[model samples]
Target chain A: MLLGAWGIALFLAGWEVVGQTGALGMSCPPLSAVLAVLADPARALLFQRALGATLGAVATGYGLGLVFGVVAAAAGHLLPGMRGGLDRTSSVIHAIPSVALAPLLILSLGRQATPAALAGINTYFILYVATSSGLAGTSPVLRDLMSVLGAGRWMRFVRIDLPAALPTLVSGMRMAAPGALIGAIIGEWFGASRGVGVIILNAMQNFQIPLLWSMVLLTVMISLTLFWLLGAMQLGAARRYR
Target chain B: MPTAVRVAGVSKRFRLDGGADFLALDRVSVSIGAGEFVALLGPSGCGKSTLLRLVAALEEPSEGQVTVAGSAPGELARAHRLGVAFQDHALLPWLDVTANIGLPFRVAGRAVDRARVSALIGLVGLAGFEAAKPRQLSGGMRQRVAIARALVLRPDVLLLDEPFGALDAVTRRQMNIELQRIWSEQGTTTLLVTHDVREALFLADRIVVLSPRPGRVARELVVPFARPRDAAVMRTEAFHRLADELTDALGGGA
Candidate 1:
């Protein structure tokens, strides 16, 4: 664990040194410069507003997608005939590039709603796949026990299937966070009202390297933090469920 | 005597890969009187467990019928009258000992009977470990919890499929004695499936030996022992004699 942390620290130091040396052009600013831009009091409100909007979109999409995915997976599990159709539909939706779907989402839901909608779609696909497989992964021995105990379909699902699926479902949530974040950011690029994606895009075109790097670094930190939290949940579920 | 469980000419065939069927059991018939302890003894893969599975309603017979309490095996299960423990124990890892024992009550859509739960916990000697989860318990303790769960509902019939088959020799013997005591108290029409000859002789009122696969009932011996048989009985000459005879039957002897 210490080695991993040390490795990351060294990589960061190397990145800063490389940028400071001007070896990779102005696009690669020193880490200190990006931090300075992020911590600047003059630009505090601008960054805060963009971050707030982005966070709101990500949260909204992630929550909705989780609920939808879990419900759909449960429906498929209970109703066997629905399994095939739901699987194909989810695959089709996932296969359509989010980039290509962005303009269509913007057209239908408008700029303000586009980011959340895209994020939700991305989150939904990952969670659906995870939940379906997790539900199917119930142990054959446990299934026999359930049958012998007079457990009905609904009882079995509630008492065994759902709990058994939790660890895998948490893993899916861990995976979906970055996808949701990326989907929101990409959606914002296609005319969203305001977000970090807009700030990053503006900084890129205007050649404000530090601000661009600051946004990217902030995004990475948030993504990693969320992943870490969900990873803990996955481990907890695994310890209990398995 | 009233028949609590009746297995009449039941045969089971499992389909393997490539459309071939493996005959697991031939025509086998057995009947257990109410409150009797019957053990199906055979070598591993001799379909003794398959016969128990039929009684538990976990499998359908390819031919013939298995009736528990004068109806289909599933009916007894549907009424929550059947209790079972397998080699795997099948305790939900997420639930602690108390909740795992109380699972049958929840499954039956009835309120959790705290009094009965505590009684059975103590019955199986798991009193202080109620809050402990399955993973925290040792093999013997986990199987004890499984037995407690099986008995919590005061089930009409108890079916045990090699419940202590995975335990160490010392633990297995200790478990057998405890199980004999437990069975004596409830006197529930019980069917135990085991490959251990000593386990069968120690706990069963009657031992039904099966031949090698495809399994058929080879011999039956009435255990000539009184209720609540002691561990000392295992060291008896009669016990040794019966054990050898059953062991011979298991070795494919006619």
Candidate 2:
């Protein structure tokens, strides 16, 4: 833990130094300047609205994606006939970049729901892969034992396969957190009314370097916090289930 | 005695990764009488475990049939009349000893019989460690929990594939002694697969030795030692002679 803190500290310090030196460009404003912009009272409501909008989209997308992913994986497991088709369909969906799909999603889902749709799509693919593989990875010996013990399909799933797949599922959840955030932000770039992504794009176009950097910093902090929380859950699940 | 488990002219074949058929057992037949303790003894790769798996309904025979209590192996399993343990111990890592032992009842959609579970825990000498998880226990302790689990449902037939094969010699012998005592009390028809000569001589009512690669029965011996046999029985002259003969047969078969 101490080593990880040191690594983060070193990285932040390096970023500050590069920004202070103007090594990259005018857009690479000093970290202190970005913090000042973030701390400014006049801009607080704007930042709050943007953060809330983005977080709401992320939550909706992530929850739906996780539920669908687990359900689809379970269905694939219980009915072997659908597994190949599920795999192929999810792969084809994931093959198309989210950015390319953003315009089509905007047209159908409208600008208001587009961020969540994009986020859900990204989360769905990641969780589907993780859950399906994890379900298949149950120990053969345990499966045999369950069979000999007269475990029915539902009993075996609840008692053995689900618990065994938990570690992998938690890890996938952690990964999907950042992906979901990215999807929401990217969706906002295609002209959402209010979001961190919208403000960042506006700042970039209008040459508001410190505001742009502040929004980026805020987005990263939110993503890291969610990732770190899920990482802890993943560790607990791994220790318990394995 | 009525038969508890019967394998009549059963053969098992596996399709290897290279798409070639690997014969595991060739027309192997064995009948275990009700309440009898039988051991299928053979060396590694002799397919004795395959035979046990057949009885456990974990695999289907390429030819012939396996029956337990006058029904198919799958039928017996579906009726929740089967119990099994393996070299890997096959205990759920997340469940404590009591929950693991109570798994069969839950699987059968029956209420958890706390008394029966506790009794079996005591029978396996894991009484005080009922709350311990599988990973927290030593290997022998884990195997003891597994044995307790196999006995918890009063299963009509117990299938054990090298339950003690991974333990040290001393622990294995100790487990054998405990298993004999446990079996004497329960008298559930059992078929244990192992390569250990002394293990077979010590615990089995009868030993059937099988030869390797497309396994066929090479020898069968009815143990002469009287029960409730103790460790001292293993030191007896009769035990030694039987052990030696079985060891020689296993070595020759390999």
DockQ of each: 0.84, 0.83
Cα TM-score per model: 0.98, 0.97
lDDT of 1 by residue, A1-242 (tens): 99999999999899899889988987788888889999999999999999999999999999999999989999999999999999999999999998899889988989998889988999999999999999999999889888989999999999999999999999999999999999899989988778999998998899898999999999999999999999999899899899
Q: Name the lDDT value of residue A103 in candidate 1.
A: 86
> What is candidate 2's lDDT per residue for B1-254, written digit by digit as tens?
98889999999999999999999999999999998999999999999999998998889999999988988899888988888989999999999999999999988999999999999999999878989999999999999999999888888999899999999999998899999899989999999999999998888999999999879998899998888888998889888888888888988854
lDDT for residue B76 in candidate 2, whole number 0-100: 83
Q: Enumerate clash totals for all models, in the order shown.
A: 0, 0
True contacts kept of each: 0.82, 0.86
Candidate 1 positional error at B99, Å: 0.7
- Give the TM-score of candidate 2 (chain A): 0.96
- lDDT for position A1 in model 1: 98
lDDT of 1 by residue, B160-187 (tens): 9999999999999999999988888888
